[model samples]
Structure formats: structure tokens, C-alpha cells
Target: MLHVYIEPVPKGQWGPIDGYRIETQDGTRLSGELLRSERLAVSQAKLHGYVPLLATVRIPDKAVAEHWTPADKAPVTV
Candidate 1:
């Protein structure tokens, strides 16, 4: 089976927006657009006949900063 590895594009390496990077067993690598979503990236790879084997998706720092809440500040649950 064709194997494809998907991972996040590091900040500033490509652009401001977080994108996905795909690497194949044959050493072929492709970086998605600055604004490409993980799903979209995977879909594009699938179109090219790459089978998903291992995928890693990282939340953008901007997004984590905006959505993350400290445990101390989280609402108490019963």
C-alpha cells in the first residue's frame, strides 16, 4: 500500500498561516498552501493516490492561544 505521512508546516517556514506537509515513502515531499486545512491537504494527497498511514495535525499557535484556557481558570464540574 502507498504510504503518506501528514504533518503540520512549522510557523514562518512557509508562511503565517499553518499548513499541512505530506511526505511519501519515496522521499517526495509537498507543502500545502499557507491557508490549506488538514483535511483539504489530505484530500489532495488522496487524489494523487497516496494512502493515509500516519497523520499528525498540529493546532496553530495562534489558535491555541485564542482557545486554550488554563486549568485554574476553567469552570468547576461536578
Candidate 2:
């Protein structure tokens, strides 16, 4: 399984999107701007012919924040 860690940073039109970084089960890290959305990030990667990884991250467990970040494993995917 791949572990995708979405580290959000202020850069583009979206906030907290440092850039899409996905880690493989073997511990390889891939970076790209196309991998921006955690929701569609995996699919985007896969659509690009990337095998989607088991995504996991833990940001501030709150409804709102100045900017969202993926520094933890709260929102997870199978």
C-alpha cells in the first residue's frame, strides 16, 4: 500500500497545498502539482498511470483554519 501525505502549503489558487507528495510502501516519494487534491490526488496520480497509494494524513481536527495542512493521519483512504 502507498502512503500519500498531502502537505498543504500556500502557493497556488488553493491554500494548504504545499504540493502533492505520495510515498510508496517501499518508501519512495513522488512529487507533482497535478497531485494537488487529496480527494482527486490519488485518482489524478492513477489517471496519470500511477498506482494509488493508501493515503493518510492528520491535519488540525477542526472545521476551519487559516490554511489547511496534512501533517497528520486523520483523513484516510483505502
What C-alpha lDDT do the candidate models reach, one value each?
0.49, 0.43
| lDDT accuracy of residue 72 in candidate 2 | 35
Residue pairs of candidate 2 with colliding backbone atoms = 8-16, 9-16, 9-17, 9-18, 57-72, 57-73, 57-74, 58-72, 58-73
- For model 1, name the residue pairs that clash: none
TM-score of each: 0.49, 0.35
Residue 41 of model 1 has an lDDT of 57
How many clashing residue pairs appear in each of the predictions shown? 0, 9
Model 1 TM-score, all chains together: 0.49
12, model 2: CA deviation in Å? Answer: 22
Off by over 4 Å in 2: 1-19, 56-78
